[model samples]
Target: MKFGVLLDDHLFPEWRFYYLDYNELKRQLKVRTAANPQGKFAEQDEAAFVEILERELEKVASFRALKSDELERRVAHAQAAVDSILSSSDKPNETRMRAVEDELNKIATEMTELSKFVRLNYTGFMKILKKHDKHAGFQLKPTFMVRLAHRPFYKEGDRSVDSLVIRLSRLFDIVRTGGIRPPAVLPGGASQNFVRHTTKYWVHPDNITEVKLIILKYLPVLVFSSKGGKEFDPAITSIYLDNDAFELYLGRLEKTEGAEAIRIRWYGNMDQQEIFIERKTHREDWTGETSVKSRFAIKEKYVNGFLSGTYTMDKTIAKLRDRKQKSDKELDEMATLSREIQLSMLKRKLHPMDFLGYGFDHEEDIVRFPYAVLEVKLQNQAGSESPKWVTELINSHLVEEVPKFSKFIHGVATLIESRVTMLPFWLPQMDKDIRKEAPKRPPTALDLPSSSKRHLSVSPSVEVIIDRPSSVASTSRPNGPVSERTPLLARQEEDEEEDDDEQEQQKGKKSSDKRFPWRSLFASGSGTSLHIGAGGSAHPNAFLNSMIARENAGRTLQQQKRIVLPVRVEPKVFFANERTFLSWLHFCIVLGGLALGLLNFGDYVGQISGLIFTVVAMIFMIYALFLYQWRAHKIRNRDAAPYDDRFGPTVLV
Candidate 1:
């Protein structure tokens, strides 16, 4: 009196009651009732065949209580009792409906044999949460209770063929603990869809403090859980889909409150992806559009791979500007804890930031100069606010990728501090637009050489210390490391220094009319000083199409040897203007103890008395560059500028 396979609340019944094997349905109904060929045995034909099998076990309880033409009239009366017991039935409805679909596919291959024939026991295990991301929009799917659990009453072969793969365990279907799992149920010819912010998790309770509270409050890479983590192992997650060669699109979030964020918006350029607090309130604007500089010069001139690793040093950024605070249920529990932290950091594969760091223009290593690619742009206010000036990317050689949503310094700063705003925002924004003073340093073969020694796969001693004007660098450390391939005397001394740069571009084109001249202000012929001019005179015809300052002297030495900014010296040119007037009297006593310690404290301090005038402007720019290098080395034995020559130093370190 106990045969089962019933289902209702969106069908689930232990996969066709532990894959239909009531002794193989009573040995195929006792070989179709001992071959009943009118060889009658009437006790009223065995009590009307046990009252039609007790009215099909009173319609096997509730699979949504039958109907749908009573389950196609009980699968057409179990295919006319398997076509009146076999007797060579042709297509009698496809051999009696493929013998009742071979008994519902041997009950879906014994319910795809779960970890073991189901023995489960769980109760109310709970978890549910939501946060303030920057604003809010989340969405989940469920519809009804997925599982309640109390089955209790075993029988049929008393269950245990090696416990059939433990009933597809999510530790027996996770009864939540904070948030993120409830979704599955599709089955009947399932379509296979999946994707949701690069998730990763394992090590049970150690969600590294819940994935460092979603990378310090929602920057999310991914997250997911359905148990399976007791100190981490079997758990693995990856959902990046969209297929057809490469569609890879993902969008599903909910969280945002305090100072609100998420402004992405890019369709054609700025190459997209920058939320790390808009790279700090637009620190001189334009953040990520996804670029690595032709993928780090094609992984260092054609797949040698390895762009940056030991960058040393971290915080010198004493806060230029950044603020977001989090709210939309903390960026949806940081996109559900960055998919268990990129599958617990085993993470691999993201490609295309010009295919990782840089790679689009390889006519071959041989750096002659003037051919580059990776450009990306998208800084949003919305509706393509054209104050104009994308001029088909003015004078393109490419590699632009500009986005600039802002905040860039604090976190999401990888690819080694974004090769300093991708080639200085692809060349030109100039001065305290905070890459701090620009014209940086390094590269000098006559302030950047190698015009062409048959593009000989590079390194003729870096075309001879950036090519030549003559200081002493002979090339090898433009901020450290290089000098390996040596020979053909750097291609026969770079073909006698490119036949001396085509006889000095034919004597500077007969002394002054050779036009292609702005070769990035000659990459550094030492013309220096780009104080955004005409406001102080640089006149190549006064702001001539604006990155201003021209008529070459290497236009401030290739715009201060272009790495595009951060290195522009000036603390009143190394101090002394009377120790910047006694360092503004100790910067007004740390700006009155950081505005009364942020009006009498709030959390972990009034954030340290609201940063005591950023440690009194970096201890008055390091004791006014150490009382002007201790009175300019007691009036001039010359020594003080060095830590990469500028930037990180209020005093030193």
Candidate 2:
């Protein structure tokens, strides 16, 4: 299950030298294996080596004219001089020894310096990896509470600290249809441009975004770091728009083509400053030959060659559809390069699949526009074979919705190349609003085609886009069944009419022997709700018709009884309890989030997003507690008849 394919890879053998040096250090000077010779080589070793070389050179000088016995005698003298230095009597001269030691130390220092140059460059990578994990999760403050305590004694905010950083998660496609190339063709032929590096938009606080670039031997593509991410590294509220994809969009401005430093208000603070990011800096030199005849001439030649070439891809959707078509031997050679191009595009935009490798070990069908290289497997009609339409009949059962001939492949290639060259120049205001809340997901084949200058709708795909803010909002309804809301308002109006009819029928029931009067004295206490106790102290006499009861109670029995009894309520105090539970949850969530930080070691940012959810869960629990308490109070105080069987769980108020 290959996620992408590869082809036409190029490399320089000179770069191999860096790898060789790194491997050597891994073997020799690595901390685990080597013993520390320390500073002696900086001084002593250099002086000793130089002195021995000098002695050997002098012996060669004497060989020109000396007798054999004389030469032997000179060698003997040199050996003695070396031996005497090593077996010196008493303390050696401090001046002489210090100079020699210093020279040796110099040599050792030189060796260390040389090693640094030899290692391959992963300059930024080493800084991030070795110093600190770039994607660690946050931890909250600790909490303490005694057992059986009524409340956790701390300000709610003390335990409710959220992470300072927002973790980006997997970017899902905001819009998708089919292929990376727009369903259109490039304006010119294949030779018009070879766009190695390009960018479509730039994020800024105000209008006038800038795109900068640097050319690499291999293309130095600009990846909008924020927009493209995997599921694990979702763009949270801080970075992404509405939890969709985001990027530090840096691209070329139509007016300003030169390099100049521009101030753009970036999203995060200094540590996370992602604004004013660079796009491709250089502009292609436009050739003087802008004639249509010249453009078509090269295109015709390409068509002729492609028709005969083995690498020609045939089929309408052959742009990217069902791309694993080469034989196993060819595929093994081509897969890596194809995958690299796809991954590069993902990074330049906002992304999702894991760049370290695919986000996971499974194949996901990604319908993104690769950087303008669609495979076409073209097969020419044989000279002695059956008729052309008969060959077509052999493939008759298969619907040729996607064209498979030479002409179709040429169109597909042209379309992709054009889109890449004309990377969208987004409206500054639109881009700003998009940056504020674009969507957690990344750009996809289905997103509004930037080349949406033509029709709104097309078969198999729609070129519909929000040209105005109103259009964006209006299209949202019925874009996917949103018109259902209008009927709900109508239903509410009908319900109001039914309530009027029911009101008159319930009016005619009267009291029998028992009297219940409240509207007289209080004037507004009409619903029979009465509270006769203060902090649980008073209640009515239970007896009826006895002399003592008659004297104490009112004559008509509608009045309150004078002889009162103590009344009490089973107290439910949970507001304080609810608060305490929240405090505990906050503590656990903070620590649990940080504990989850272990995943920061992974290549993608999505793993850190899991920490954010813990805090959200704690918040939701607190909200639910309020709902429960409100419902409990509602059950306790609702209206009910005296001594009725249906009346249950009422508090004496």
Please tell me which predicted candidate would have the highest lDDT against the true structure.
1
TM-score of each: 0.16, 0.12
Tens-digit lDDT track of model 1 for 1-653: 11111112212355444222333323333444455564333354445433443333333322212222343354345445554544444323444434454443332233322211221100000101011010112111121012111111111121231122122122111111111234532111111111111111111111111112111111111122223342211112111211122212111000101111211111111221211111001111112122211000011121112112122111111121123333444444434333332232223222222122233321111111111111222233335332122222222221122332121111111112222222333233211011111122222111211122123222111100011111110121122111111110111111111222146543653333233333222221111112211111111222232222333433434434323222322335444445554665566566666656675674656766566545665666565566555554433322245423254343333
Over the stretch 373-414, how does candidate 2's per-residue lDDT look in tens digits?
Answer: 111112223343332222332232211112111111122122
- Cα deviation in Å at residue 524, candidate 2? 46
Q: Candidate 2 — which residues are off by over 4 angstroms?
A: 1-248, 252-339, 342-653
- For candidate 1, give the lDDT: 0.25
**Worst lDDT 10-window in candidate 1:** 121-130
